[model samples]
Target: MLKKILFALIMSVFFIGIVSGCSESSDKEEGKGSGKQTVKIGYFPNLTHSATIIALEKGFFEEEFGKDVTIETKTVANGGLFMEAMATKAIDVGTTGPGPLLNFYVKNKEYHLISGAVNGGAVLVSAGSSKISDLKDLDGKKVAIPVIGSTQDVMLRKALKDVGLKPTTNGGSVELFASAPADTAALFVQKQVDAAATQEPWGYVLENQAKGKLLLNWDEFAWGKDSPNTVVAASQNFLDKKGFSASYLKAHKKAVDFIQNNPEESQELVIKHLKELTGKELSKEEVAAAFSRLEVTTNVNEEVIQEMADISKEAGYIPSADIKGLIDLSTLEEVSK
Candidate 1:
């Protein structure tokens, strides 16, 4: 059984004030005048990560971190790369999918899942001209995923298992190809891959621009809306920074609120941010559709996170499935009291 905590907007407001307040006090006490501490952040250039994007665009993180902290960022192409950056201490904390976080955590045990970023932005899509209409039609087809052990890859594998089919890694008909989500659209257009288990707005882009058809939408896929797609992960060092993790979540909560309360403005901000980050502009319709597909929240389903960890372990991507102490939401819990 997973522990579920669905935080309300007003409850989050209370949580943020309590958490960030502690972080501020701790920093002041460290008044050794060590100057400024730099916080290295990482995130994918995907709408699944719109909260983080909106935070950066709106200066939420800067506002929360205050004048004593220096913020640096890196745009990761996929969750695998994002975790890798965390491993090398290149990224102190940032947003990434649950799959890669668990896959990396099993072996590294170096990450603390601080908050949930988004849920259900992944979709299963096939070529528009292809005869495949659903998961059952995926036999003998080529599927493109962001990476071998990515969140979408795990979802695709689970869905395939349900259909009594498997990717070639398990000697099944479907062959899995690892590609960056941004580049998967070309493969879909060139007819190079039969389908993709990808995150938005690439899923949206593939449909509108590459004639890709959605076989399963975000809410209809493997775990459906229950899937915990994106989460805020903190490196070991970051968590050790007294109340830093709590402070980061304060900004995270603000971003989640901004997205939920001002979705229309969020879509435009996402459009501008993605364009600036990737130089690949997306239409408003696609961005809007993509934005609507996922749920932005700070609450996580621990059972779903556990199941994802198990799936990765079964897929031979991780050494073990025991991710004890993987999630530390005590900061949020404490402040609420």
Candidate 2:
């Protein structure tokens, strides 16, 4: 009886050891699979940031991570708020125009232009009763922008000045105000505002449904056809961590591939996702037109980014002295996957 009892105890201990070894191996596999870090991404629902929406729908992030990961989304009421979030490290990555990024950098904050999000989607629209048929006609008009320090605001200021009109002066030639993009479009429709410089899908909505006419689609005014309207940015700290940024860049590359390869399918997905998040579907025409106006490329055009910086500087959004060292694009070169 004593021998049988001892034998049973020995077998139980051996089984437990095997189970322990399997658990450790399983954990290591999971660690290798899931990546050593988590990524929190921030993006807007507007067409300016359609790439992010399409990316999420297509499972690009998941493919890159090779395991379960967490993805977070937040809506920035304006570019100022977005920059504030970046400064505080509330998000690891974000998508927006270069204007805000440059401005933030000038203020001594650091961020990396990790990848490209979308190209052009910006447009200038005038209310039906407004006499603005071109940039030349924008003289002496009140314009609405999503925010004072936003990319649209900077672009509008530059476009106006390009036409020989001063935005802040020249006999009150231009009055620019800040409001949400959708709200600005509604105000344009109500005739409370003469025009608005806005990014896509919003530009599409205003033109098609609100009786606004397009003064300039993206190509005509800002970066011309292939300009990088939105870029993927990351905190410097996030970039310094091992393998985290690589995983993010890999995911971003997949997103670019998915967008370029499957635009039509991506558009459908964007509409569905946008509606779920925003409570409305972008019209088929809007999606089609907006997509046409945008190029989904990961190259952050240095010239265009510099132009955005110059615009912000000249417009008094950022001091001219700070423009030179505003960009920390080194990481851009690092993660150009």
Candidate 3:
């Protein structure tokens, strides 16, 4: 009788262990089945990121991702900060300038450009009273760019070098000051800076409100016309997840379409969101003038991007970069189909 009881107790203990193991396994599988619970998107507040702003304001991302997935949007001031968010996995996807995006991609081959957000909208502006008339006049004058390694910065550096001038940082004649677009506009208005190479609608603000002059519209510059200013990109981790990339691209395409089909309404949306993000409300004329300078589209021109990469490399902003792998338009194409 004693032996029989001992054996039965041992059998019961063994069965309990098996059941516990099975339960743990089932829990893990359930966790995997749940997939990603939240999707974090990062973007700049500039008009170049209008697609991201409009999509977030319109609930297009939420509607596409459904209620199960929480969509969180983070507004970054510059492309460099946006890339930092991506590096830390704080943002699953982002919209940034081609300059910062290419620089990041060269260092960390973990992100890929999924689509283009906006093209053009950048300008080289000088104070109305300034003697600077063109890039040639930029010699020995103080010029402001949004950020040191920004798209505008890279373009300005190359343009100045081509004009036989150089940025102060790069041992040249032009004195470069890296300031926020708004601050640049204010400085230009106050006559604190000689010239500002900045993006629109801040360029518009500087020209109209700040009494600045447009020295060079972006179209006249290399890598300007239909160039990729802002691009939508996703991290490798996000791309590894099922269904998330597709949903994101779908919403992005929709936002681009909305921008094209509803111009006035889209401008209003951009204005409203810009106010919410930057506390700066632009007038209808200002917004319209800004839009006239920018080409908002979803098409990613690989050749233009490659040219940008080459420029960035030549400027020593990045090491050798193979941009072919940096671009993955398959997802965008799939969404279009």
Candidate 4:
């Protein structure tokens, strides 16, 4: 009787050990699925990307993503690098220009414009000494763009087209310089470029720091307020994560609301964030000035984006502008609803 009792105890102990081991293994597998992971986001350090800035600074992403996920951010000087990072899977979701996103989407359908960020925060400025009083003056002068084929570049091309001028790349007289916006100011000070197509507060910076003159205001620029300057983009794999899109868009919408509802505070926040990112302390003047030209909203106009794509194709940036599946706002619609 003692031996039988001892054998029963041993069997029970072994079964419990197996069950405990299985539970632990299952837990580890679950962890691999969603327990802990790092999410990488990318954006340019421009006012046009303020939604991303505010989202990060205000901790909206943290609140939505929770404690289990880590948020990693990468800031690029130009849209070309931003899209390049997306292509290499360096970033999961963040903000970028509609033009760069569309141009890249045409070549590689690996990403989608999840939502609209900010619209019409860009302008065309001529150096104070360049004697470029109007668009036609750009015909024989050098123009700086954030990047070749960027949103600003496309806008510059359009403006040039209106004036019967074109970038040398397009077989016209205007000389195009592909420079980072931050560096474009130095180009102006050095007389390296006569004009620049850029977004604020860089436009404000050019006006103040480099004595740049605004040749075309935001509304006067291509598509004006209808132009999709900054937009939310996401890699396909990241969008595939369960509930990730909803969480991200929730944070994005929250940030946009903050920017809209709290105007003065939002301006200061942008100034502080810009200083932190660029090491340049911007005044309320430029921040407010940039804010004036910008419309922060979650509404993305597909018709405007389609127009941008058409302009891109006309400029030979892409073979065709058929971005049929480039925009998948189903998640955004669901989240908004």
What's the CA error at residue 90 for candidate 1, in Å? 1.6
- Residues 1-337 of candidate 3 have per-residue lDDT tens digits of 9999999999999999999888877765544334537889999877888888888878889888987787888888998998999999888996898888889999989989988888888988889879777779888799888987798887787677677887766677888888998887779767789998888888888888878888888686546676567889899999998888989988888888898889899999999988987788878998888888888788887877787787678667888857768998888888899
Candidate 2: stretches off by over 4 Å: 1-36, 169-172, 321-337
By the lDDT metric, which is better: model 2 or model 3? 3
Candidate 3 collision pairs: none
C-alpha TM-score for every candidate = 0.87, 0.83, 0.87, 0.87
TM-score of model number 1: 0.87
| lDDT of each residue in 1-337, candidate 1, tens digit only | 1233444666788999998888877776554345678888999887888988999999988988888888899998888899889999889999998888888788877798988889998899898867689798899988998888888999999899889998888778888998888788788778898899989888888888889899999998888888888999999888899878877888888889999999999999998998998798888888888878999988888988888888788788888899998998887665434
- Model 4, which residues run further than 4 Å from truth? 1-34
Can you give the lDDT of residue 285 in candidate 2?
Answer: 84
**Candidate 4 TM-score over all chains jointly:** 0.87
Clashes of each: 1, 1, 0, 0
lDDT by residue (1-337, candidate 4, tens digit) is 9999999999999999999888877776645544777789898777888899999989999999999988999998777798899899888899998888999999989889989999899999999999989889887898898888889888887778777887787789999888888798899999999999988888998998999999999989987787788999999999889999899999999999999999898878877898898898877888889999989988888987887898799889999999999998998899888
Which residue pairs of candidate 1 clash?
A: 2-303
Sequence-dependent TM-score of model 3: 0.87
Q: CA lDDT, every prediction? A: 0.86, 0.75, 0.84, 0.88
